[model samples]
Target: MRQGLGTQLRHLIDLLDGAVSAAYEEAGIDYRPRYTPVMRALEGGEPRTVSQIAEAAGITQPAATQTVTLMMKQGLLEASPGVRDARQKIVRLSAQGEALLPQLRLCWQATRAAADSLDRDMPYPLSDALAEAIAALQTQSFGARIRAARATTKSKKETS
Candidate 1:
């Protein structure tokens, strides 16, 4: 049997992320591809709350929290309590993180160029396909689609 869609998507992501991670390693940078979203979110040098980080990074709060914690452990970021909401954590890049920007910026530019080349070679632009998929999912979630499929399968089985 052919591999499922989820598996295929995961394999694609692993291939891309692995290559990006290897490039960072080749550059002697101790950074992960997963860190890119968070780093970009904080690149403006504005201290933002975890919720703000999540929104800016286009990730969930829990994901943002997890990434922030990892970055902190790497000394790439620092966090302090929010001024108005003492419970909310405000995060910013540490000096160590700032130092990495020059190199990261170069890597990012190269990566973008590479992606553009890839999109040009493909039948459809990968970035456009991803955007359309995300928009469709927002309109009707994957779970809803799965449920509808299941209902159709169940009804067919009943007749059979």
Candidate 2:
């Protein structure tokens, strides 16, 4: 029997994750798949709040917060009080984090090259297709439920 589309996609994701993780390890960098999206989101000119980072990263606020905390401790990020809202904090990458950006890019490039080499004869469109699929899935009911659950968990953690 043929495997389901979701199963194939999941397998692909797993393979990609492993390749990326191995690349990061080989490059002597701590691998955090979750942090890459958040860092990429913050690559824009503006500094972002934890909530904004979470939204951009497609992760729950609590997860973002925890990741931010870890990055901060690692000197990869710095948090400053917001100008208009004293209670709010804005997060940005520190010098160390900025320095690591190129390494991250290299790791991605290596992973992409590996994927491309898997089927050299065929034109590989998986990256673009996967990105589009993710964007579409983000607007679906399952995505909404996942995000809501993450948010709820974050809120509960904060309250406790």
Candidate 2 residue-wise lDDT at 3: 100
- Show the colliding residue pairs in model 1: none
Candidate 2: lDDT over CA atoms? 0.82
Q: How well does each candidate superpose onto the true structure, as a TM-score? A: 0.95, 0.65
- lDDT for each residue of candidate 2 in 1-160, tens digit (9 for 90 to 100): 9998779988987987877787788889985766787788787646899999999988888999999998888888888999999899899988888888888888777766876776564576666666788778766866687799999999999999
Error of 2 at 13 (Å): 4.2
Best-performing candidate as measured by lDDT? 1
Task: Return the lDDT, model 1, position 38.
Answer: 96
**Weakest 10 consecutive residues of candidate 2 by summed lDDT:** 119-128
Model 1 per-residue lDDT tens digits across residues 64-132: 999999999999999998888889999999999999999999999989998999999999999999999
lDDT of model 2, residue 149: 96
Clashing residue pairs in candidate 2, if any? Answer: none
lDDT of model 2, residue 100:
89
